[model samples]
Target: MGTVFLAHHLSTDPSALSPFALKVVDKSLSFAADADRRARWEISVLSRFRLHDPLHPFLPSLLGSSENADILCWAVPYCPGGDLNVLRHRQNDSVFSPSVIRFYLAEIILALQHLHGLGIVYRDLKPENILIQQSGHVTLTDFDLSRSLTPKKLDPDPLHVACSEPETDSDLSRTFTRFVCPRKKKNVNNQKGLRKAKSARVSPVSRRNPGSFYERSNSFVGTEEYVAPEVVRGDGHEFSVDWWALGVLCYEMLYGKTPFRGKNRKDTFKRILMMQPEFMGKQPNALTDLIGKLLEKDPTRRLGYRRGASEIKEHEFFRGLRWDLLTEVVRPPFLPSKDETELTEEVKKGGIDIRDYFDKLKAPSSPLWSPSLDEQRHNVSLTEF
Candidate 1:
């Protein structure tokens, strides 16, 4: 919820010279309480993966954190390859080939699976938050919007067993391995029947679902375009929401833009509620079919609703994928060039000391205090009509 900078540790010890992306939140802002909470929550979430044994290569582990009266700062490995969105734009057609999409999507699925396994729901899942590693593999970033829900445990069943079985796709060896290049657009009008316009986006929340292992939260929070229909309806949502977003991410990767986006925010919500995803210039395939199933309006009916990722892993789209070998693959779709991997000296200048940057933002006014600018504008009232 604040600015990120390429930074180096301020310590004099050379052993601590590794580069990090430092996120700083100014506690002097009007939304300081909420911002502080989100920052703390993210640190807690990342600590799990950072401290746990068998750390995930597809997620950022917290390097460190510091907070004072004026600012809060935390660091993670800096991704020089930028985000998936940047990579998408670098592609010749601004879209990825099917094989490249599959490669990236598989890693994302694995990342989400690990998060869900830890009882955390990654409420936000857009291309911007999917960071590329120096090795060209993907790592999920920005967990401040994520929610920690109670883990759901279902009674073991035969369908679950069958779905969890990983199949090998020989075709994967022959698939296109080229890496690709990757917004939300919104529209609003005074429609009579429109629901009161909340902010175009929502925040993540923690809630428990009764009589079900899949925790359901009622908080209205997510980027507008990627929000699941159940979430839009204010129906309590659970793990299935991530699957819906994964579908959106997959579609955007293949087409270079998000499906269901409309002229504005309200129009986008309407499309999300009523329209189907448009597949331009391509015939239907297992991938498209899988996207369709994941985007089903009814969360209970979504592709991964029952067995979670295991169900999607068994789909024809991923038929030949060697899930276990994903991390071992030597040739990924794209590798970040040396420039992207190393922090530039320009960024390192003054950025090494994170506290100084945020300290300058603190004001003499009390943290929660707001100046009454309205009082100064007595003669002019724009809303007088």
Candidate 2:
């Protein structure tokens, strides 16, 4: 447990406390957004465990959180280890046991099922987002782009619905606030940022009672790379986007890259719009079949029938899974031996390296330098903190 503590929700005022991790909001503006909105965003996450809690074996449990300045942060149980994506990059990564991979994939399916059940769709499902705990537990993180699997609220406040996509500074700040909230010197730009953020949130979209909500005027947002087809065409999106991302993440995990690789903004969107991704010798037939169904352009036939938890658990790839006996299911099949490195020393020191990596990714650069990440990746290392 964190020496200090806060609420399970990342947005709230619980006194000035430090807990699970000492994350810093990269920008001061986002850190100041209203707490109730943050609470709602995180509720989508915490409520998800009704399908997979301690019994699920893979997902992480919510520990707690605290308020530091205007930001409310969660104390997610620290997974004192590394993520599968990091493991894959190492030369010894080839040593990853097949059984562990199976366990990871199995749990992912269950997670998807649980989210789908509640009508929640996790739009960004990457290997890096899945945490591997010291006890071999796998907790999913970064549901920031996740959409409601059920009916979306009729009139969500645009102020609270921000994300890092759709090219809005507010979205970037919203992500920045929670992802980066534990710095001293980093606050250099914060004073001005907080002013700008406050204006954005307070500038009334309408004069109809400041506290009341009406229809949102903002576009739905997501990282361009992981965004789904229906979303790009302005045709409207749903839980299907999550499945598409899941396919992309799964492909990248096994093949070492996304199936459709484009460096140009128009080209990437065009590729998604018209081209068929080359499976090459990249993955096995079962894997290919699974991705093909997900990447289909048509939202209806795509994703197969949105199945229940039992049906998802019984998919061909997920064979041998005992739905009712989930607790008996083994940990992800391919764990790297729990070396000394597996128990992260950072956690012992009251911090986690997750924010370090994401912080290195940095809050979105100013609108002045705004460029597609693909273009930026060629010229700059995004991971440089």
Candidate 3:
């Protein structure tokens, strides 16, 4: 769960707004130990590219992030529109119309296009992690695990690449951290944070859950339910991890539950690594076939590896989608609304920048308002005094 801060107000009532949802990684968690700080810095570093990327439903446009940004630890646009995960859970899931799924797919494709063009691999892609804006746009968010592949490729020596799996222990950390040293160590020049986090062979999962462990306890990234097979088996991991996750998400969306789930972690990875996904109980054949291809154990066989997002969209399931028309399309399938007046008043108390996020978009082709690079660097200092 994340701290609920009001990021902005909806356009329906320009006078008021809704809350922004931002999840801060707990310092106690290995991933978030420095992830919050890293996310903002990464954006700042990539602001040049971010400024040029088109505003679309698939990516939640970053507003601003700060060290002590209240209500939410990380600032993002307020999206009262919720997401597919909430919609399916609260209401019900059914065969989405071609219009609905196609439109959403376009947004997803566009998002991937931008990220991939920049050579940024978003390793985590899931419904729960996505954001559907108040304006009915879908955005892929939670880029904390994203990495730049092009930069790493520049190293002339193969030594720069991660080493092969170790034989001493089943875990990879024990064998690697000694030499693998984090990528951020040189960038941030933060040897201190690096050393503390590196002092681990295996980080015990949080105490809240007795058996809790790293997302891919095998390698130390995403959650167990969504971790990629390559990561679990100690195969070299890369940006493609996100594509693998996208497959998992597509599977979960069509079915109400994850493709590979178990009572415990060991059993879970066993299913992911060995078992094949099946179309269970009255599911669409088209959806099932898509997932079967998606949940392939080998990353090379998975969707979006060689051919890219267009290829994934062109899969038989999306045969009818007009890729050209998708970029400009609007009006998603189901748009939920509460009492406009009540929501507006509630938003006034919801601490987000209502005008900046919701009303500020000038056109679909052009976003007139975004956090200026200067403002993003030097956060606003408010006074409650």
Best by TM-score: 1
In candidate 1, which residue ranges exceed 4 Å CA deviation?
10-17, 151-211, 345-356, 359-385
TM-scores of the candidates in the order shown: 0.78, 0.59, 0.64
Residues 126-167, model 1: lDDT tens digits:
998999887789999988888978644544544332223332
RMSD of 3: 13.9
The segments of candidate 2 whose C-alpha lies over 4 angstroms from its true place after superposition are: 1-40, 47-57, 68-70, 91-101, 149-219, 282-284, 308-312, 323-331, 336-385
lDDT score for residue 244 of model 1: 98
Per-residue accuracy of model 3 over 169-246 as CA lDDT, tens digit each:
111111211123223323211112111112122322221211100111223567788877666655445545777777
Ranking by TM-score: 1, 3, 2
Question: What lDDT would candidate 3 get against the real structure?
Answer: 0.52
The 10 consecutive residues of candidate 1 with the worst lDDT sum are 176-185
* Model 3 error, position 18 (Å): 7.9
